[model samples]
Target: MATATGKNAKKTNKQTDTAGTKSSQKDGGSYQAKDIEVLEGLEAVRRRPAMYIGTTDARGLHHLLWEIVDNSVDEFLAGETDRINCTLHKDGSSITVSDNGRGIPVDKHPKTKKSALELILTTLHAGGKFSDKNYARSGGLHGVGSSVVNALSTEMIATVRRDGHEWMQSYKRGQPTAGVKQVRRIRGHGTTIFFRPDDSIFRRTKFNPETIRQHLEDISFIHGGLKIFFHDETKGETHELHHPEGIGAYLEKITTDGQKKSVHEIPFSTEKDDRGNRIEVVLHWTEATDEEVRSYVNGIRTHAGGTHESGLRTGVAKAVKNYMDVHDIKAKGVTVTNDDIREGIVTIISVFLGDPMFQGQTKEKLNNPELSGQVEGLIRPGWKRGSTPTRRLPTRSSAGSCSPPALAWPA
Candidate 1:
């Protein structure tokens, strides 16, 4: 086709585009700043809960619960407290999470003039986790977890056991009903949040005991030192999940539950503190034909996977290769691949970082570019350390010639 070139082409296209825009605007009406809508208070979260909690279905309903629990867990991680108790009320729609940690401050906010507890429960992007002063590594980024829950909840009550006495405040749809009230004299410190998910927003407001129990179990596995108690008033039962054995025990439980036998008598696992971040991993070879990995960033599950998983896979492959080279083990006519090395391997990787970049408000994936390298660095060295006198990889030798040593369980 014949066409204009260079400067003439640019001029022609620009004129045509500008003229078309003017014509369209004249017909459709002009755009105006008035068209924009600024959602105030917690209305933005209420208007579109999915943007923050992923979905308005059953999962999102539980996300509201998770946000509060995670805040308490953050306290535990900060070495502020230990015990966390979660109660599902008989009404089925209400829940109460109590933690024996340094409670939310009840002092007047220097800027807002609102009580710290009230401000935290009523505002978005307002929390102590914004800096390392309160929490070294917290799952609460954007500082909206508690407030979002309050916004979505029909009623929320925040009880703080600080300032020498217990302070109680109530909120309705993210607005404080009244000023902080001083409850009867009480000792110690912590926070208790009671909330009911707004029925108008969620398809189902009833909290599933099984779903919550499973989640608590998984969290207990991750934070081995933290004690979690679940009181299911639905069944009048109380269950406690405390596994000081940590992820090592978690791996064993998962494999056992899956009916998969481990190739190693003892799985390879590591728990190391790098500065403020804690890196944890537990894994072993199995009889399965494929691999499965579960990764988490800052106590929040990363279901979509991310740089951490990439680092894990790379470090694992490198460790295998390094071990082969160090031992002078080789197969003359065979080739080893990363997939082969990882086959039938199931692993759980949990990392805690001071600042983690989440993919979205849902925090379903981790996006930090440096995290992968950090994870890999830890994994490689961890594998070497695990290869001590009592722990060794499988050795192989075939009659005709050595086949690529099928990575079996460690002996």
Candidate 2:
């Protein structure tokens, strides 16, 4: 091995081989454990929180809540958990979520040799979602949620009650203060995540109760009857949202009030196969003015309205047009363009499968191009199956009718 000085090449003395000895072969030098590399700590996140989280403002503050909620959603997807309890402190700077789902696995990760929980919290992009076999459905497709939240929070505490024991861990600015340690022995399984956004990183730590309420409310409606409780510890306020009728009840809640109904609500759904792929589709036709279609893959909202959304739109529009043509009903003067047809139209599209590709860090869209055809093909032909058209009156429905739909799915 040779050593050099940057200032000027300095010759290092080398011992000559003894008379009968042979020279050592050291061209590249020996590779050993000491030569192995390790990345620096989480200090980078403190320097650039925005790079990981989109912003350091109110959106970012809310992101902390989303990250935590994303975890609870994962539990909900797996049959391990159903209820998500969220509480906002009166101070408005903190929020906590408790889920009865199977808590994050506390076992060791084979690759990292660290507790899976710790690996998820400390390392970026580390979790079950990475392994196709382990996670069939995950909201946080790109596993940055926990680590990002840990990185941005001034303080975060995670409590895991599993396997007859209670384990707890805490972190500050991404560095774990203590490793995963048993806090106590418990009889059940679940997880509680409490976090306080760093004022240094966040311009404001205050949370919007309405935003949280709307978010949970939407999830409640989507999942339908998945008991979601919201409590404001600071204000002593508590509210619950759950729907038993599922999407049908969800549609009725949104479409029936004030003014005559112009377009009767119609639901089109069926199961179809695409290149050996199977998908189930649920769609509702409404004459409502705005085009409101929400797509979810395994409870994860595809807000971007990707192929799945496109497929539903294409399939439903084609099906409706075909239905009108078959009946020789000149909707000509009726003029139900896709936009017109969807105007004030509120529809929910959900696709459940073993494999789903969600685009981006937020998992807001279904990216699989095949998804469009899968979803569209499933509902296109089925549109006229058991289809009954209703007339829509040119009047607005009451708020009671518009009061967000209830969502209830059996636990």
> Best lDDT goes to which candidate?
1
Tell me the tens digit of each residue's lDDT in model 2 across 1-411: 975665434223222343213333343346567997655666666677776666788877787788788778777766678788999998899888999877888888887788988888888778777655765666676677888888888888989988999899998878889989998888888999888888888888899988888777767766664878999876798988776556655555555532224244345445555564445555444544556676777666676888888988887667656665666645323445565444555667766656677665666677788887777776666744553544332223232122111111111
For candidate 1, give the lDDT: 0.84
lDDT (Cα, 0-100) at 315 in candidate 1: 88
Please list the C-alpha lDDT of all candidates, in the order they appear.
0.84, 0.69
Clash count of each predicted structure:
1, 22
Task: Please tell me which predicted candidate would have the highest TM-score against the true structure.
Answer: 1
Q: What TM-score would you give candidate 2 relative to the actual structure?
A: 0.77
User: Which window of 10 residues has the lowest lDDT sum in candidate 2?
Assistant: 402-411
